[model samples]
Target: MHLEAFLYGGVSAVLAELASYPIDTCKIRLQVQGQVTDDALTAIKYRGTLHTLMSVCSEEGFFSLYNGFRFAALRQATYGTLRFGIFFSIKRMWNDRGGTDKNLPFLIALGTTAGVTASILTTPIDRMKVLSQSTAQTRKRKIVNTFKKTHSKGGISGLYQGIWPNAKRAAAVNGAEIPCYVFVKDFLTNTLGLEDNMLTQFYCAVTASAVGICISQPFDTAKTRIMQQKTHRTDIRVYEGFFDMCRLTISNEGRRALWKGAFPAWCRNGPWNIVFYLVMERFRKFDQWANQRDHSYF
Candidate 1:
């Protein structure tokens, strides 16, 4: 189960989620903008990330920024824990079979595997999050109501809507994020002969955040749109699936639309990467120290 990996990943993810969630809310709001299907949502023009943050606070109150936070936190705990746990578990197995940590391909594969697995398993929470965040923030909505609405609208499939896009986004994100962080950290520490410290970790996290955001933003945009689609409205279908969403978005809004909310995503991801990797590394060091102490006692 790689319990330690799961524990560390959950803790790091929840803490990171807390720190970056407002930016995340802003990102979601931006991504859903300029979409044809968003007519059901309140029409609030957000100029940019800052504008969105300001507009949301002015109109919806400050706490509106943290709307759907419970779902976000739960999503992180389940998806984050599973992804990290599975990644490290597979990594350990591969190492036992004489695989090298220096292999970039293996790291990417592990990340993709972990991300897809986790995203699939915890998709309901993700759906609820999108539903809550993409709605008109003018009205205070309960997270439980979001769940009930989804189930009533489409049953289990409703909760699983956008799973494919979510999975792709997760795969892209984790594939880039964890591997970039690990690779950069390894290069700096092992090749450059730099000590493992906060500075080095910071550099690695920044690189990873940039790479991850670039690779995953499009899928993230698509996922948000798909999940935000009103299932109750059978008269209008905005998108059939992930590729359709991308095509329509590009055709209607231009290629740049795919990268919508990218700045806010990066803003959220930068701190998220730093916090996650820092905490993860510290947990790993503690685990190693505990193992060493136990071995010495033995």
Candidate 2:
């Protein structure tokens, strides 16, 4: 079950990433737009999701929107694999140990644990993805060059920038996303007397995505700023830590800055979640069918 969960999660995540990556690029750009304190550049470059999308397409070319595609896809695969796999594995363990009634809190705890573990393990790839998509210069830079530069600045630790905020963001996202999906699906099926079909899954995924984005946006904003900040010395970063990042952003860019790129994040994650749940649900049904057929054969 764990292996199957990992496989389904990775496959769905890669496909979802491929489908929604341009929006993600736009989100990153918007999140890091006014990070610099230059008075001349204080104006927001990317006005919103549509404007950012149009600007990137026109100025940087359409393909540039997929900058750092490989890094982001890899991060999605590994992180998605572990998060989903661990969540299901732990749930199975809980069920075996007389946890027959899985409540919202129980599922949320599992999802958060899985998300934190995956986020910590894959923070470097996430850092690279953010750095690669944060600006026009980074959009053209290769991941190897980015890796070398980051390594030069802070050795191995450089690549793991923003791990704290990233992990927190993951916890928020995962805690809300998967649990909401499961809870909503169950409600639709058992309470509302709806069929467990694609329509139900679609509704559940959209709800989950919205909840995840709302909960995670502030942390996501901080993580992007911290990861994309220009640094000469690793010890002397613009934002010392997660709280420092939030404090500086609120002070310099206004409190609203904590939710920067939130719309774009929802646009990206909404489609991503829909695709992920659809694919994962299909795979699960197929696996169940296959197991049943094998048992009949035996």
Distance from true location, Cα of 61 in model 1, Å: 1.1
Clash pairs of candidate 2? none
Per-residue lDDT over 181-279 for candidate 2, one digit per residue giving the tens place of the 0 to 100 score = 988887888788999899999999999999999889999988888887666644433778889888878887789989999999999999999999998
lDDT of 1 by residue, 116-220 (tens): 999999999998888778755656567678778789989989989999999999999999988888778778998999998989999999999999998999999
N/CA/C clash count, model 1: 0
TM-score of each: 0.93, 0.92
Q: Local distance difference test, per candidate?
A: 0.86, 0.84
TM-score of 1: 0.93
- Candidate 1, residue 82: the lDDT equals 92
- Stretches of candidate 1 exceeding 4 Å from the true structure: 41-44, 138-145, 293-298
